[model samples]
Target: MFQKIFRSYINSFSDLRREVWLLAFITFINRAGTMVIPFLSLYLTKSRGFSLEEVGWILTFFGLGSVAGSWVGGKLVDSIGHYKTMTASLLLSAVLFVLLQFPVSFWSICAGIFLVMLVADAFRPAVFVAISAYSKPENRTRSVTLIRLAINLGFSAGPAVGGLIIANSGYSGLFWVDGITCFLAGLLLLKLLHPKKAKENVKEVNLNPQAVLNDKPYLLFIGAMILFGFIFIQYFSTMPLYYSEVHLLPESDIGLLLGINGFLIFLLEMPLIKYMETKNSSALQNVILGTFLVAISFLVLNLTGWIGALLVGMLFMTIGEMIAFPFSNTFALKRAERGKQGSYMALYSIAFSISHIFGHNSGMQLIGEFGFNLTWYIMVFLGVVACALILWLIRILKKEAVSYSSTPIL
Candidate 1:
């Protein structure tokens, strides 16, 4: 029994390249500093004196910048190469985080958050392209999952400590600590990741400017991503507020719950993914099933007001996230041609960015007016629609795969 468990673990972890491991380290470092996001609502409401509605709009602006940044980052990565783009973006975000600490007025705060996200979120596309560039084709999903493991490990620490940071040093401490970590991550990437060496493994990047937009099937997949993404964004956006304001849980309690989210991903995700990969699970199956789980997680919140229920709900949500996020990324990689990987990833990323534009507003408004029950039900409805769209997207992807295979070279 012990040997089988050990073998399963080894099988799930083996076969990743050295470059993939280094990139995972950078991911872990980058995510370790992720204190600002989980606590941003509390920071805004308690420290900055913003109302819920105002914070919603400002975060929405941040999302708008994120959308533009993801698109631009893809083009930039394709142009300048992934290493330079990622390092530059991370360093720039560090500077912006410091600048954000100086803000007094609302518009300044808004502009600061928007600019910070524009710089920071650009890192997403570069990392995705790098992971694809570094991993073998068969191992891409696990490569991404390994990176997520690092991220969740860091996440497990960031917030739990961040609650204590808030207690000891106040909001300014969060910003400074976050900024310093960003700087450290950027520096580590510069020292460690040799892009020229890794690029040799993957094919030469395609520099065709309009290549990604021409794919109709990929476009529809992005549409479906956006629908489900709106709900996913709540994890970072309004969910913390629900715990803090509605349930009246302390920040420490919220952090512990989110830590549960991280631990679940860390402990279970890779093994389950390995099992699924063995069974030949389709990407669309991951997306659709994950969407159903996300819907159920939200509905669980409404079914009970107990703290245990929140933990159970988060466990469900974390499982869905582990399944959905990795597969969606690998799905984009399969659909993209070489060199266009960055653009495909950027477009895939925009689904979440676009969702942020309205996700917070809708959640906050519905809760403020109608109440949490209605808000959760609406999330359930959207999840069902997102699953339906993914089903349609699966058909489109299958048709394209067949067409590509059937075409004979003359």
Candidate 2:
């Protein structure tokens, strides 16, 4: 029985190339030291003596920068190529991370965060483009899922280690570790990852970013993604603040709870996603279900304040995330003709950026004004709307589905 399960596990990773695996390793390394930002809210409020409103504005700037970065990176990847964009973003972000560690005022911190988020996240679109370029269509979602597996495994380690680091060496230590790891990842990519890997089939599709914008169905889908992103981001932003403020949980305890999310994703996501893919569930269906699960995850929190309840809610959210994101990414990328992958993926990254901006900033205000329960209630309502929007996108895409009906899908 154990052998059968092990074979099943290995089968989930089949059909991917070496380049895909290499990218996953790079992602794992990059994410492993991503500890500073998760704790940034508490650091700003408790240690830096900023108000929740102030932190909201600060994080909003980060989101704005990420949006800009995604656009720039996507363009650069298409123009100069992914290799240069990937290397530059990582190296530049390393410097930015170090600069952000300096003692600074509110405005200075905001500026630092903006630049850091911009440079740091610029690599995202490039990574997405690379994955699409390197993998076969049949293996696309699996490639994304495997890379996400690396990220989640790293996340599982980063926060737990971050709690200890913050406890011992303070917030500055978090920045130092993050900076060093990012720099190392850049160097490794330059050394091991090849630009040629991302060059496959690029000449086949239109290179214009405008071409992506012209697709009505794709645009609607991107819009829905922003809604999904808004809900998903609360896990990283408002959820922490709410837990710390209401439960009075220590950073270590909060870290543990967050770690559970990554741990669960690492353990269960691949097999679950494989099953869903095998069962031939539509990506839209998966995304809608995932969105609803996330809504339920938050709604359940309203029932009780116990730590156990929060953990259970987190488990639900992680499962939702596992189902929704990889398939959603694959779904969107399917719309891109070959040369437009970078541009398409770049636009896709913007949805999440908007989420970070709107979700974090607005969630802070809502919690401050009305309180946590009401804020969660509103989130549940939005999730319902998001589910509907996704379904609408499905109807729009169905017009074009006839051409794609012959292909095996995620």
Candidate 3:
């Protein structure tokens, strides 16, 4: 049975073998470099010596930069080819990575992180554009899932390696490691995915904002994603602190917890996504249920002290993420017009970047003032709001479905 399933999966990718492998490899390497950033606060405070407020500022700066990058990348993908935009961004990011390794002042570090995020995050929309451009709609969702799997696999390795590097050589080592990996990955993409020029007939599609941003349903979905992102950003910012303060998990154990979360995503996300696909579940329902599970998981974490309990909370959180993310991407792709997939996905990407600018700092401040339990409850409240938005989006989509179905493709 297992062999049969494996064979079936292989058969599904027969046409997309080259594109899938190229994307997978690129995703893995790029994500491996992500390790240097997420753990950056730990590096700053624990190693280079910075305050919590400073960390928040740096993150906020990075977020602001990413917001701009997302927009620019989307537009560039519409105008230029995906390979060109992605290569430029990735190559620039590699240079920025090296700059970040410099033993600079706190202000310099903030500037470096912001610049890197701006340039590096630009690759995100380019990647989504490439996937949409390369694959037929029938295979797009699965292709995205494969890329996500590679991301998780790379992430699993990145943190463990990051932790070990930090433990031995400090934060500088982390940046240097990230720099080397990013440089290598960027070169690989440039060499392998030699992008062709944009076709003239598709130029009209590129001009339509309605294709990406004008629809009511899509806007509603973005609203929901923004709220979801706010709560989710806590995983990086506040969750580690909560573990340290309330649960009394040591620093090493916290790293292990995050590693376990990444590992589970690597192992289970693809299979779970495949299973969900078989069930014909709608995207809206998945978003609602997933956000609910994530919120509930936080509540459980607030009450539990045992490592087992924490792991269980993370399990539920991962489940929620796995369900929501791919479905969200697929839904966005469907909602977008032909050739505007990059713009749509880039708008979706805004959620995380926006969350970083406001979400983490806000949560951290709330925790600083009100305490961990209150902060967790606030996250739950945000999740509830996200659910409401998802439901609203579903209604909007249902209303538009018939109208769109009858309309001629422009």
Which candidate wins on TM-score? 2
Give candidate 2's TM-score.
0.88
| Residue-wise C-alpha lDDT for candidate 1, range 102-148, written one tens digit per residue | 98788988888888888988898999889878898778889999998
| Global lDDT of each candidate | 0.82, 0.82, 0.76
Residue 96 in model 2: lDDT: 80
| Clashing residue pairs for model 2 | none
Per-residue lDDT over 1-410 for candidate 2, one digit per residue giving the tens place of the 0 to 100 score = 99999898788777788889988998888888778877888889888999988987897887888998998888888787777888999899888887788856999998888888888888998998788778877778888999889988877778879999999998888889898999999999988888676666444555344477787777887888888888788888789988899888899999889878877777777888888877757777888888899889989999987878888888889988998899888877776653366788889999888887787778878989999999999888888988888888777666555454345332
TM-score of 3: 0.86
Give the TM-score of each candidate.
0.87, 0.88, 0.86
Question: Which is superior by lDDT, 2 or 3?
Answer: 2
Candidate 2, poorest ten consecutive residues by summed lDDT: 401-410
Tens-digit per-residue lDDT, 1-410, candidate 3: 99997776555445554766787898899888777875877777877788988877877787888998898888887778678888888778877877787855888887888788888888888887677666655565667878888887887779878988878987778778787788888898877765542231132454535665556667888888898888887887789998888778899999888777777876667767666656656766877888998888888866756667788888888889888787777777666653366677789888778877888778878998999888888889889999998887777666665332232110
For candidate 1, give the lDDT of residue 181.
89
Return the lDDT, model 3, position 352. 73
Ranking by TM-score: 2, 1, 3
- Name model 3 segments beyond 4 Å from true: 1-16, 42-49, 163-176, 196-213, 302-308, 402-410
